[model samples]
Target: MTEPSTMLAIDPAAPGGPEVLVPVERPVPTPEPGEVLVRVRAAGVNRPDVLQRMGLYPMPPNAPTIMGLEIAGEIVAVGQGVARPEVGDKVCALLAGGGYAQYAAVPAGQCLPIPQGLSFVEAASLPETYFTVWSNLFERAFATEGDTVLVHGGTSGIGVTAILLAKAFGLRVIVTCGSDEKCAAARALGADVAINYNAGDFAELAREANGGRGVDVVLDMVGGDYVPKNIALLADEGRHVSIAFQRGPRADLDLSQVMRKRLILSGSMLRPRTVAYKSALADSLVRDVWPLFAQGKLRAIIDSTFPLADAAEAHRRMEAGEHVGKIVLEVP
Candidate 1:
């Protein structure tokens, strides 16, 4: 079947609030070399997408201005040298941009087969969070079996994925949520302990919950004041991986403590990375993470889903911070 000349997309014209995300007509993109044209079934909404909508996150050079980072769809066309994932193959892809549209041109190597028995929305939720946690928690922090990890935002997409990965890998996990309900939700999802961050000192609570040994790793998305507390919670030679700074970016650190504890502080931003680098991450996910999804050992925690035209409402839901997991947009 011939593709349409245009498709609906939520690309804001200017930096502003959720009200700016209005559906607009955009030309259907053709597959570039080493790429595939996917008829997007769904796209995942992330914190970065919120920031992008507000104009706080800058688009990488030559990237599509349309807003989205991950999408799940079916391959409709393939560019040169793309021997695998022929027409009609179902895939979920990580994109630097352009995922919010009905159609997306994705790098071939950045595409992963949708796991058996998973919907497009579930598959759509995997790329961004899975790639992030796998890269930082396991690859960068080298979190191995028997380690204890403290994950902030227990009910969030990243936090939930961390809990599941920790459980599947034999690690003890403690998570923090804003409310008792989310705490229970986290525990039900296999977290060893879930603390309500608003009730008391999360560092103390997490430590006590972990039997007072302190955590071997801390996966922090909240920066600023939490930085010192996070450092204090780390055991000797502990690793701290920062993925986002919702509170604020700048943090005060104690160099002496860092030196004495032999702690490592590191973080990474995914959007600005090269296609070759992200492709490598996709390969790693296929080897180490995709099987867990295929076997039903891991599942994406979907909080809510909206139609493609309701993209504005989806952003509002995310910004409200009440949702328990990923918010997805189903393409019409």
Candidate 2:
């Protein structure tokens, strides 16, 4: 079973639209020290991939230029200093980049074993959003049992994962969706409350849902004017974790609110973090969350999948905001 020297990938000719995500031939990455080469069966399509395609997302220094951030596949080769995940092990890994391809080289520690009975597509969908949600919503926000959280973009990958993780850990989650349909979807996924942002003021609705106390944590992706609104909804000593700013980066907020409430505002971009940090996160997920999946208490919710060559369509679906869960790309 010799690996191909070159693989089909979506490296992009230049920064542009979804059309730029065309498949092209690129040399398959060899596993570096402590890394493993995955024969990628599937890859997850993420917002950062779209940002990278448009040249909007800043590339981490010396990171791979390819447009994928997560992949699930089988280990075909291993690099020096690697142990445990030998050749032929199935894994899904959070990558620095280079996931939209037939093969990817990833640090062994970052490659989490696929949960029992999950397909490659399901496995692929886990890494990026799971890592992001666990780190920001659970770790950074310090959301514990019985706390309530306000999660924006209820149907988005990160939002869905937040809901599931919160439910698994006994947190009450209030999520904001763009439509009634999406809100219903979120409710079906165990969210304590789902508010359609277009319906009315989400902050008021979420506060009412939490018995007028507001949320202990806010997982915000929609930035800009929403920041102050989110801040207004926080309970005393609340934590706000920003994972994206789709609305815009700048925010006009009242500093007096921060002082009075002792709010903590924190944000993180997963790709820029060191391998050791991400690996530790992966380890944490394996220990704390993977068992839930294995026990059938949790499952990957996939909206759709595309062939590796149809990455453009995947991006378009993601951008359209019509999908309720993860959009994935399947490889040969």
Candidate 3:
């Protein structure tokens, strides 16, 4: 099959605000070897996408750059040596870039069949949050049954996914959200305890909720002022993983608490990792987690969906922080 001359995509004119994300036309990308061309139906709006737009996160080196991390669509064409998925198979993929487009070229190995009973919009929400949780919480942090896990930003996409998955795996979950309403939502989604970060100190609250014993794992995206508190809130041999530093990256803190508790601290950025790592993650998700989604034991929590042309509005909503779950852009 031949690629089309042009397709619709959202482009950042300059690193600034939502207005910078303007619609543009670009030539459809062809699938390279071991890749497949997908007709994008929807793309998830994540904080990383907003960071990329605001210059906090720079775009990967290229021109006519399109920014989106996850998409759900149909495979339209396959490149050399591809097998398994045929034309028109519905799939959701983890992409490095170019997801905010009419068509995207995705590594074939990173594409997963859309789970039963999920729409394109829902499927679009899975890759970034689910992959992050699966990789960090379960895979790297060594979270397991009977472990007590604490997740910050409890109402956010990552928080919700982590809460649900941990509960499903028989781990007690404690979470911190910005407001009581958000905490309620987190509890409804399976968190055993939801602390209002605006009203309480999360470190102290998590400790209180766990019967004086701190949680086994703490998944934190908020850094800076919360770092010392996070270290203080861990159980013996606990794990602390950071995926983002929304507050600030730099911290001046004492390490005695970490050593005293025998805690493990780690952080990861998914985008810059080698393709092989992502491919392996995708395979692991398919093998270990897809069954939960297929059985309806896990589901995507979508807060809103915007038209592809309204990508600017989507960014505005995300930046405002009212959304409780994943936001998506319908690409059509």
> What stretches of model 1 exceed 4 Å from their correct place?
none
For all candidates in order, the CA lDDT equals 0.92, 0.93, 0.89
Summing lDDT over every window of 10 consecutive residues in candidate 1, give the lowest-scoring window: 205-214
In angstroms, the error of model 1 at 33 is 0.6
Q: Lowest-lDDT window of 10 residues in candidate 3?
A: 56-65
Instruction: Write model 3 residue lDDT over 1-332, tens digit each, in one string.
Output: 66577999997767888988888988899888888999999999999999888888865555236889999999999999888576789999998899999999988988988988999999999999988999999988999999999898998889989988998889999999888899899989989999998787788878998999988998989999888888888889999999999999977667888888888999898887777888889999988888898787799899999999999999999889889889999996
Compose the digit string of candidate 2's lDDT tens values, residues 1-332.
Answer: 99889999899878999988888999999888999999999999998888889999989887788889999999999999998699999999999899999999999999999999999999999999999999998899999998999999999999899999999999988999999999999999999899999999999888887887968999999999999999999989999889899999999989999999999999998888998999999999999999999777789999999999999999999999999999999998
- Which one wins by TM-score: 2 or 3? 2
- Backbone collisions counted per model: 0, 0, 0
For each candidate, what TM-score against the reference? 0.98, 0.98, 0.97
- Between candidates 1 and 3, name the one with more favorable TM-score: 1
- lDDT of model 2 at position 176: 99
lDDT of 3: 0.89
RMSD of each: 0.9, 0.9, 1.4
